[model samples]
Target: MIRGIRGATTVTNNDAAEIVNATEELLWEMIRANDVKASDVVSVLISVTDDLTAAFPAQALRRIEGWTYVPVMCMREIPVPGSLPRCIRVMMTAETPKAQEEVVHIYLRNAVQLRPDLSLTRKSEL
Candidate 1:
């Protein structure tokens, strides 16, 4: 079955390094939380708030040892007033045996507000 795992995180600055680091952090957390292997990932779709034009969030995947083969795309999110800035979000599709209810979605930093119900606590065990 194909399952979707959603995650989001915020960068403190618009700098490329900050964006890449924050995106890497979010992706690792999601991978750990979902117990997903790179081989299981079908594709990853990433989006960033309009304010974050310094870097492509998908670029962070290069640092993930085995994720080189995973297909990824990045886009600019619609600029909504009052929406959080410097937010990087991802929707990952993967082939998994786990049911939808068992899938874990993650949100960190200011991005937690984007999906409160799916947000994992900082101390939550994966």
Candidate 2:
């Protein structure tokens, strides 16, 4: 069965290094929470708030040892009024046996405010 794992994180600034580091951290957390393997990932879709323009978050996936062939795309999130800033969101599709509810959605850094209910397992508390 195919499953979609959701995750989001925020960077302190629009620096390329910050974006890449935060994205990598979030992706790793998502993978660990869902027990997902790079080979099992069908694709990864990432969206960053308009305020972030230093780098494409997809670059983070390429840094993963076994994710060279994993398809990933990145784009800008719609600039909703009063919405979160410097945020990056991800939707990872993969083949997994776990049910939807069993999948853990990760929210890290300032992005935790984006989904308070799921913030129980925030990176800082993990």
> Lowest-scoring 10 consecutive residues by lDDT in candidate 1?
117-126
Give all candidates' CA lDDT scores: 0.88, 0.91
Error in Å for residue 98 of model 2: 0.6
Q: Write the per-residue lDDT of candidate 1 for residues 1-126, one digit (tens) a residue.
A: 999999899988889999999999989988988888999999999999988888888889989999999999999988989888889999999888889988888888988888777665434644
Q: Could you tell me how far off, in angstroms, the CA of residue 118 lies in candidate 1 after the best superposition?
A: 1.6
Top candidate when judged by TM-score against the true structure: 2
Model 2 is weakest, by summed lDDT over 10 consecutive residues, at 117-126
Please list the Cα RMSD from the true structure of every candidate, rounded to 1 decimal place.
1.6, 1.9
- Judged by whole-model lDDT over C-alpha atoms, candidate 1 comes out at 0.88
lDDT of 2 by residue, 47-117 (tens): 99999999998999999898999999999899999998999999999999999877889998888888888
Residue pairs in collision within model 1: none
Alpha-carbon runs more than 4 Å astray in model 2: 121-126
